[model samples]
Target: MADQRQHVQGTLSELGTPLARCTFVIVDLETTGSRPGEARITEIGAVKVCGGEILGEFSTLVDPGVAIPPSITLLTGITQAMVAEAPRIEAVLPGFLEFAALDRGTVLVAHNAPFDTGFLRAACGEHGYDWPAPTVVDTVTLARRLVTRDEVSNHKLGTLAGFFGVGAQPSHRALDDARATVGVLHGLFERLGSFGVDTIEEVRGLRATPTSAQRGKRHLADDVPESPGVYVFTDAKGDALYIGKSANMRKRVRSYFTAAETRGRIREMIPLVEGVTAIACGTGVEAEVRELRLIAERKPPYNRHSRNPERSVWLRLTREAFPRLSIVRAVRDDGAPVVGPFRSSREAELAREALHHALPLRQCTQRLSPKKTVPACVLAEIGKCGAPCEGHESPEDYARHGEAAREAMTGDPHRVVEALTERIAALSAELRYEEAALYRDRLAAFLRAAARSQRLSALAAIGHMVAARREETGWEICVVRHGRLAASGLMPLDSDPHAYVRALVATAETVPPGTGPTPRAHASEMECVLHWLDAPGVRLVELDHPWTCPSSGAERYRDLTDWDRASPSTTRR
Candidate 1:
């Protein structure tokens, strides 16, 4: 029985800090006014509780540095004489902050958190003391979730305290009110337990009420282990309806039944879901990669991302006598420079147009023969093309333009930007503002795709790499091969990471090389890896290759144009 109880506690702790193990400093304050700037806190009181027992208490009267208001004094019975010899807020704040110990997993609780925390933060700011942002819990919010209007007239501290029959009662005093709030917090926890909310995260995310469908489907998540992983919602035939990933598998699955699951499509998908399949992963990044792979393979109806990675288009130089820019779905190893795995063909076309504005490459799609001269289209007359179709530009001459375009696509794009900028400036000077704006949009579209392609290529060139990031529990280590997440694992706090890294690397998935920048891996997966690598505190554990990108990649030219703002729909990755 003792072993079983320990097992249950251990399981609950894995989700997050279990509510029973959390230390809460219930606080209450009396003030001269309601709002922060308009008010001054007069009295501060707190009771630190862990596992329903009081560890210590902190109470102090603060001098507001101003006269107490008559209405406030009358309500709280704190007369001006009562605080004449009290310590100023500067002295009192340090003691209060020390007692809270917010940095050491001590959660701050208040009846109305905003009011108390606001005044405290305001006081800290005014005195030039650093405000340690604490994880705060509001008893009023918790009570409203558990005790409806039918059970209590209102969720005020006094009403909740009286309903719970706590030892202390609110008497418009800080210490008494704080003591009353602790009891109300404990009472709410009792109610939350019935709903299977055992962790601090669950307590914080508790909803007022759950949908009937959500309540009925709660059992679907019962078998999910408490770990980071991917989850699949399946219909009766065991086909996937939706797929998702989260740091905690059990917590995320259970949340689908709560009111917090508010997405319309997901709400609709829930009624059809007959079961959930959980795949435990070693880290959050691995779960994300797994979710993307599963979604692409299964094509889950409810998943929008990575569902159609094959549909991505690219802008590449065609293999012909007079090679022209073409939008293709698949990349080839023909050595022609390719620009994208664009989200859609429309974006690829936009990027193509931008490149055309820089180089007078032939706009025609038909095969052109250097030996035979064919009549050129009107684009040749407009000088938009070098008219290779009409044999006006020889294959040798067209090759020069193609090589320049190739340089812009693969290496530096300064010439492309300079050419476009000259045209835009010339148009704007001629009062052709509309034409200039169009050129600007095209430039942004091209740069956005180029920058994303370069970033993806840099990471995808590496054969094998291992990286780790510091987490509360330990290090989140990942094994990446050609920018694909091969495997992930955790090294417990205070343990050597070398052995764990070796084990994870040995068990990682074997990935084969593919053609182009993002070899063997989906562009989305590479982009995810780039984001993780760039995040703060990530340490490179091992690397087989020196990962690098062209210094003149389009990313360097972002400051030269308002690309991000003008081309908001520019597809990345």
Candidate 2:
């Protein structure tokens, strides 16, 4: 046992502040009930330890001043007779608090902290003693995050004690349970060390701690700059491992090497990272756009989203005698209007459903000649579709419904918005809340797509423009073309801002218009720029044309996206 204690102390010293140097108070309480205000603590047991050695121990039976219930007696084996001669809580608490005070950095450990802490706090409040809030570690929360369900049947104190081969078994007695908890606590610390959790900060934020391999690469972040930039982590083969943007490249890059990064995939990839490279930007907005472009171009293996526009799906209104909404992989300039660049086919399908339900447009996939007749699908009989396949609706009339759907997809979304709003209201009134939420989600998807389309359209229509926002030391200038950032730079504050703006415009990098039908890369870059322009206190210094969303369009539905409200109707304009 002496050798084991020395080994534990040695292992802790190699980590941050030697765990051996810190004081931990493992506490347990036998209580009458779960809550503190309503129930009272029958017994308090605590063991204080440092350097893997027990420094002190405290145990007491408290007179709760109430009759002990039969169920409580059965659970804890503490009867009124057991505490008949015991000191009252008011008399016992003061000594316990003194014993637990911090000579070194002190921490309170409990199986499930709230239960113990809550009762202790209540006891202090009732007795008119101020409760000192100390650093607390809940083994229950730690176990849940670190241990898999397969490792143990449960996170209960007894289960953990048995699993860790604790000498003292919890027998519904406070002291035994407190001792067992100390064993469990040590076992957890050992497990966390394997995952690169060493310091008290890492232990407190264990859930976000990176893997041991990632922590081993802390040296790689030494040279990173403290500036807005895009960073790429690379493998030994010189291939990109992961790409990210940050307002502070040094801080963000350093976080990957510490216990602060919680992402499982990033932690796995960090071991492969042999180096990191960064490109500084004038502003956070520029860094974001550069990150997106690099991720899209490099196709980094670890980048999950926005790496490939080809994989994105869109809802298209096909050009035919009777237009129908269909989910397609790529958008084409085939004179057929498209609603998205939606993140997934599922979202596009939802938007398609919302539009179909609102507008009496055809839902067929077949190409119908103006005179040819084809069998209609069940959607026609259900009154969801216009049945243009069966010639039940004339081309002119079907075209009007198709036009309305197209309008909603492009700019005007009032009809579709009202339809979904009414449906959500009806479903909520009927107590079909789940179905209402589904409709609400579908409505939000449509509105978001419509809003994006309108914003992109407005920006693209301007062709070319220059905008500037005032900064502390200079003017941040950006040259935009077809809604995308053509170039951006920082110009020192000059008496004549126009001269610096011209120089910035001349020096900025030129990116040609995208060749793809949707211009997704350009659209993404434009979205980044739009986000920057909309930032608070940003002022547009110059423009070739006015930049604005459609006056009475999908932009108005921005408020409806707040789905957390009890009723959308109450928040709707």
Candidate 3:
């Protein structure tokens, strides 16, 4: 570690305030260099203030142990040779902190503080003196806030001193600057009547603007409001800090903000925060779905789930109109076409590879985004994409087929069954039993998918995104979305058999309308699934258990694990 670091720990805890506090030292340094990494402090000066009164003043030239820059020679009368025999920070910093009595509520007051504080902290951390230093207030941020244009054009210490007719005498001398700073702070504090900065305890207790910002980001977080949707906090980086889902998003989110008023850590976070974002959904169930999808995309930092958004992509229907098929991609880029409007070749490749499954469209060779000059894949000859190659199919036809596939993957799975049903009816009417049987088997598989769709629908009803995993103890269920956690329930081998049956039913229910299975549809399946997942005796468990019930291929349990890391819908804004 460097000498600067010695001051970090030693002075970190030593930062404090004035008033009912002990003496604070406003200090300044004239340096031979711009950065602590290379620059050496040429001069150090301090003015001690206690109970709003100057207690003492001190200034000194430091033997930089290095040659002073010519600029330094012109600016302050200190020369290259003047400080060659002077004291170093090792000798001066400790005395400064001691006089400041930073260990006793004495804060450091400086201008453009981070630069100086950063240097000071670096020094403390290095010396092993570990400053345990008191708080350092930047007169810069304070003066801009307190001095306002009506009183002054600039807030530089020299400017403030000039306003009070003190002029910059002794000019760049460290002691003079420090003295001038203390005087300026005193004048501004008296004029403002109050610092207007209440205690963390006082601000935490109120849900109003905890920290000021634009309208969108104000303190609407008192209680996550009463609404069905997801809530988010986005920092200045446009990165999500947290995400949550609730029928009462207002109240739930508000609960986190208001409830933590007493937590010092939370108080610090609230003030640094920019604002919150929300997505309103159709139902609390819809909110959960949307939340899961969002969590999958926007990995807000404050969210435990936020970290996972980038690693996983959800299977989404690309075309959505007709040739129903699935594609794995981040949600935000959905509208950008693989077939048009100019897209990169890499994205097209990824879209195909991720969406590639045991399905027929897996063999496409067509370029994605902005229809390409080359068209179709080898599978097209066999009717996979209607042979868009060699102009056998029109661009409209290609789009239609792709649309159909996308639609099949998205819309109701019933559409697949309906199309298959028509094929089966035509085959049977032609008395082609063998072909009809093939259609029948395909229909069975289609019917299986339809049943699974019902299970996904039911997951939403319970206001959760469920991911069941096996553990040594039993099955663990992680219900989450975005970065916010909704619930984690476990199903142990020792649990009630009835609840297990219900879970299986969600995965095994008969098909709904329009599929090749049964023509009947029931609205209650989702409700029943909700009742089973949430029944009181449920416990949280890991899903890796050996004896857990098997899931059909359609059950997206793998997605739970992957999406546990996968970003929800990717963001555009």
Q: TM-scores of all models?
A: 0.76, 0.65, 0.35
The global Cα lDDT (0 to 1) of model 3 is 0.50
123-194 per-residue lDDT for model 3 (tens digits): 677666776656666767766655677988887777888776654444887887777777776665564323
For TM-score, candidate 2 versus 3, the one ahead is: 2
Model 3, clash count? Answer: 92
Q: TM-score for candidate 1, please give it.
A: 0.76
Candidate 2 lDDT by residue in tens digits, 389-443:
8888888988899788878877689999899889988887887777887888788
As a TM-score, model 3 comes out at 0.35
**What's the candidate order when arranged by decreasing TM-score?**
1, 2, 3
Please report the candidate that would top lDDT against the real structure: 1
Clashes of each: 0, 0, 92
- Superposed by TM-score, candidate 2 places the C-alpha of residue 37 at a distance from the truth, in angstroms, of 3.6
Error of 3 at 471 (Å): 27
